[model samples]
Target: MKMTPHENTKQFPALAPGPPRMFAPQTSTAVSRPKKNSTACLACKAAKRKCSGPDAPCKACRSTNTECHFDPSRDLRRKVAVKRTIQELTNHKDLLESLLSTLGSADQLQFDKVMDLIRKKAPFQDIAHAVGSPATTFGDPQELSNASKLAILEYGENHIETSGNGVRRPSDPGNIASSPEEIPNMKPPQWPTVSPYARVTLESLCDIPLFEVPAKPWTKVTDDDYLVSHLVSLYFTWDHPCTQFLDQRIFLQHMKLGDRRSEFCTPLLVNSLLSMASTYSDSPDVFSTPENVFSRGQNFFHEAQKLWEVEDDDHDLPNIQALLLMCCVFKCQGRVKKSWMMLSQAVRLAQDIGLFDTPAVSKKKMLPEMERVRTITAWGVFNMSSQMSIELQKIAPLEYPTSDVKLCGNEDFDWTPYPRSNKITYDKKPARLPEVREGLAELTRTLVDVQNLVSEKRRGTNLDELWRKAQDPFDRLTAWLQRWPSVPEIQPNPVPQVLLLRIKCLQAIIHLFEILNDPHQPQSVRQARFYQVKSVEETAQCLRIHRQSYGLKHIPSQIVDAIQTGLRILVPQLEESDESRQAFAELCRFGTALSHRFMQTADVIHEIRKNALHLGVRLPPEVIAIFDDPEQWRSLEP
Candidate 1:
């Protein structure tokens, strides 16, 4: 090192001289360290040392020869857990709030008990029971909306108490149930007078009251449970099968039990049904003043209206059922405008209750009974609304439900016949009512399609456009016919009620074919003629079944309408074909026989007679004899 300057100067000078004096870019003395890592290993962080990355071994850990590990979500897990805890607490708080709000009107003792149970962390069922909502099981808020505590309390408080199966007892036994002064306030009759025999029949048959009726002001006009029961039996035997709305088993069971609190039974519903049933009864109490035939069931109608008036906040299944019955009552009373209005109201209310949206209910599980009620009521609304619309010559207000809600289970068998009535028998067992309803519903949907096509044609849609639109419904009709089961030439002992539904389908087919073969349009004459012939043949089969199964009086009023419509449609062929003439005669006989029962039928018969006279076709002697002989009609009365 001491001689470096001179000795190194000579060697350096020799090297510089060889390559011309470049100092090789002055290399630095400092060394670069491994890049620092933001996400460091546990060991590296503890040691306050930088890490290169999250590789198998970081720079600091590798130098120290220590194990390294990292928690990827350590920071986030704590915050997430805190948030979930907050949400759970919030839900519990909401539940308490809703419970308190629902039970605001409860007595202090019960409310305090509920509050204490909540404080002591008791089960929701115990708390709900403490608050007098035995049906309540705390779940989602939507469950509360279905049956509120207030509704149950109001229903229990306002309705008259039922003592047993015999008679309904009033809440205040000391109070006089009837008022003599109220009779003066009653309105006069609106329609034509009744025959004197109408009032005398019931009075002559049973002078003494058979059984006690409900001790209510509305029901005082006819205080006989035996008569009421008979009327109810008649309704179930005839009208119930056609509408098939109520759960007969459950309803009759509750009715027999006199359980007013039961959801399936309500005073309004019972009275409304009685009002509808009166049309088939000969009871004098059914008449408003023992003289007005058109005022039949007026007392029960008023009772139903009064009960409905008191039902302010509640809109449960019974309300809808009662409203439907009320609509029918109005139609029977010849108040078409009111019936239409009531039907519209029912449809709106049904939608509001989410009965129409069955799919939405699946997410929030409903009780079996409630779900069944909703499904059947949905179908009822659809059927009734569709029929009313068809009658009024308007489009259907509701579409068919698309949800997979099912019919009642098979365990809900045919209802037991009313105990005192001998109308229903094993040998004359009709088709299952549900099957007939389903068939009618499907047929009504097809009819709706035909109606829409007819409406389009009325709007003057071009022929090609109309034909193109018609294909889907036409094909559907054909497929429906293909799917229809064949009827035996001789229906077993008593013809099933399902024959009527088949006849209705045939009528629909005929109507659709008529539309397709409209004279103004290019006609599919051969196809139309084939269906027309088929319809007549099917109708004849139906007539044969009816003749074999039961008397003309037992045939449904709907069948009478069908027969008249068919006759009117075939009037042109009457002069040419012997078969047509025979059908015309037979249909007239049927129309005249039923005409005594229905006012519209009488009017229809008169119009049909006028049309026949215009066509120079004379009425059959048998049909004329039916109109001339009062004894014939009197015997036909039920």
Candidate 2:
């Protein structure tokens, strides 16, 4: 069969060598050919343009005035073959080098057939070089650069540097800039030192145990969300350090991006910052403080204020609650006007959003404290205005009271028969007096309305209603007091409005007692009235003291002075008549129980102010004179 295959190739040899016999090329036809133009030579295929062959410039290139030289190296027929052969040899060399680097002699032998095929195709010069030089030298510089880059990525700045200056060096050890320790020999900073009352740490303040798990288990002792909410609540409590965490750089770093935790924690964080700022503003120990803390706190408050204003609908309640806490801090710091404005805004927001009327069946229980705050604020305004009026009266006495008295009748009529009692009669009204009386009545009415609303079972109504009621009475009272007429009789009853108020209060108390005494009333009602009586009495006592302190003579000055002297006398006569004992008891029931302690504090303050006072007194001589005289000393004994 092998002989038959060879015999077939021999017999077919005729088909291989008869190409000289032509089918149609024997005839010589005189075909008219177009003349080739030397000025417009065909472009070379590789360069896509005409080229001058061997000559310095061809006719076409010279006509175009372009530089022209034939690329003698562009041998179309043989170029591809030469390039392919060189590429094949180079590729084989690279493959062998890769194999040798990764494997030993046995493995290298596996590529022997591939090496032999490459040797057969390669030129003699190439074969000699491949045998003489190892394949390792053929390693590409591009590969080296790529490997170096990968190493740099993994090891981070541990690299060697190759410079154009022919210097090969390791990267500077001190210049290792990838890690936190890049700054040489620097120790990590210690946690900031803080005062015991001032210092607040995240761990100490937060129940972070709740945040330990990814998913909140229904049966767990505490879950993450619940813990977070509780932490927020704690942060809002008075003087809590949870606020400090907001401004901490470390805390911010830990609050990872794309995390929902920060959104839930925002209200607490904002509130805490506001509180810290307020505390700094309010603290009395200014000498031992850092200025930056106060400034930082103020900045935080401003930032929080902006954030709170733009709160999303879902977070509106928490946001408002945070704002309310800020208002409280402002109030406590004596920034009354600012606090009132903030509180007004908060109340408006609560009403507009219907937060006050939120069903109790919802997650959060409605807080009664908000209504309580509003009531206290209203009272504060009233008290502040009243105090201011009293001060104005002291400094600038009303001229009408000090002016000469004129009779309305002629000399024949003796109009002095009826003695003036100095008391303004509420029953019979005068022209100017009615306005004052009406104003006082309006204030009383307003106070009653506020008291009633406050006493109701703590449902949030329109806070603006209470505020408007408060403002109307306050404005009227202020205007009336400021323009109060000064008659001769009025001077005797300096604060006629206050006197009238006292009388009305006493009447209310009497009515309340009557209600309590009624057998038809419920025991709870009676008990409530009893408490009301105590409160009213306490209020009356305070008003009495206030009037006395202002130098008003609605109650006789002699009676007030005697009472003060009698209190001192009764101190040693502790076992005096029940009446005297009752007087002492009454004084104690009022704020006078700590009068001695207050007096001591006052004496210290007075000592500081003595040099500043306009009037001078010989205190040492007076004291010595009093102590030197036995009778005077005996008289001073309690």
Candidate 3:
């Protein structure tokens, strides 16, 4: 019998006793799949042999004496393929999460181990095989995980909804769970309602991440604890919330109760309260009456003073300065007696601290506060004098009658002499009229004294002080203008304008006399006096022009009323005069040309305030003209 294929193989000595296994002839498919050759260094593309490109002097090239240049394109292609494999592996979020969960459960998780696991599970057979067999795999699992998280986070942010629809589906499936809509809207778990400790913790969390805090079904953090406490303080201290809940009194009380004793207390909050009180004092409706606000403001000032007495050295000094400013603001709104008392205290404090005697401690710091104080002082004086003038008019009808005495050619302008029986003899002693004249005279004298002191001190101080003193004369003169009519004329014949002019002339004359009398004064000082004389002459010319333009028949009781009726009507006609307009245009051009020269002089004066250079270079004639005619000043563009 013919031997069977297995039986024949078994019968042969080589086959032994084992059953014969049929062997197929080797084909292309029968051999194992050829592995990509990663070990073939990129430098040896044409050779089809291993190379040592990375190591210096590639062995093959050295042997052949050929230059061994790295084939960067080949290396780049390999690197790209490796990166593509890794990116695909990292993009599989479900696989990564599953692996993470498994490792977490085993308690054997490590970055390297996870990375190894990822390489084993990566989609590319090359990657899997390479990991198992060693030569061609790439990537780190930690790096891949980080990349995945970053991608998901970006997708979630970009897709968050503006409309009612919560979120759009993520373009990448790996980001599905990170969707805003998919995350459960679980309220932060509620703790007991009355627990302060829990509330503090919740508030801290809310403050740290304000945007993340939810607005939904009642959570442990009620808006009251999280929002109200902090916001109430901020709204009260800063200018926000846009609501007028508390007046000055109630607001101060609430702030004090909150134990909020920061710099926010005085200058920020209390000073704002003082400003409100002042505004309300002027208004009829808001706060109804400022009495309560004023009282509360005074208390706030005292409180701030106490705080300042013991404040830390490092705290802002400007805040304390602001407090003093508020005190001045409140005091100005008070009665004359009260204002006087407050001003006396303020001046004493200012002087004691050498605020006024020396250059301001820090000009940038203190100038605004000083200006505020000066403003309050000026306003108080104006109001007081105005009230006094009104009272005097009411009391002495013969002297300060509301109706004009008609000093024209009418019977009212009677030149009758007093009867000898009624006329008290001036030979032995003149009869004293009353306290009214004495009081007014004393007040006027005091004002003049103060004016002189300011003028004297101004010559030795800074530009700011000089400017302050310049304003003082104007203020005093204005007050005197209001009171001048009350005084009986010293001259036998007085033109109403002439009488007013005389008072101004006297003031100017006095100022001029003082400047001239000082023999040791510098030439610059003499030049300054010349400009000042020119200013006085211009003011006199304005008064004369005013009187002539009005063509008034008699002396009017109110100087302002007379000037208003006279000057305003004349202005348009005066402006229309070709000669006047030409003169004004020339003055404006001259002022524009000379601004640089004046600025230089101002800078020089600013530098040497109390020496030969203290007085600025004489003001130009055109600048002087502009001050005399404000309409001309307004016409010019800066």
Rank by lDDT, descending? 1, 2, 3
> Model 2: which ten-residue window has the lowest total lDDT?
409-418
RMSD of each: 34.6, 42.6, 34.4
Task: Output the better candidate (1/3) by TM-score.
Answer: 1
The 10-residue segment of model 1 with minimum total lDDT is: 128-137
The runs of at least 3 residues in candidate 2 whose Cα sits more than 4 Å from the true structure, single-residue gaps closed, are 1-269, 272-289, 292-296, 356-638
Candidate 3 RMSD to the correct structure: 34.4
Better of 2 and 3 by TM-score: 2
Off by over 4 Å in 1: 1-221, 289-295, 332-335, 358-363, 402-405, 412-431, 485-490, 493-496, 514-537, 633-638
Tens-digit per-residue lDDT, 263-295, candidate 2: 223533343333442332212221122211122
Order of candidates by TM-score, top first? 1, 2, 3
lDDT per residue for candidate 1 within 166-245, as digits (tens), equals 34444764342254465566453243433343544333444332223342322444666677766777677657776767
lDDT per residue (tens digit) for residues 1-638 in model 3:
98775785453356556678898787553447855544444446677877765554578878888766664333423445345544455334323333444344422423354467466764432222211211122345665555446554544454322234643443545544553456688443243322111223332333321112121111112333333233233322221111111222233333445433432233343433333232211121122112121122343344445554665534232343343344334433323344344334434443333334332344444354344333323222322333232222211111121111121111111111111112232122111112222233333433443445444554665533544555655465456545554223423332333344333333343343333333355664555444444333333334433233222211122222222222222223233444333333332333322221122221222222222123333333553464334234223321
* Estimated TM-score for each candidate: 0.60, 0.23, 0.19
The lDDT for every candidate, in the order shown, is 0.62, 0.35, 0.34
Instruction: Name the best candidate (by lDDT).
Output: 1
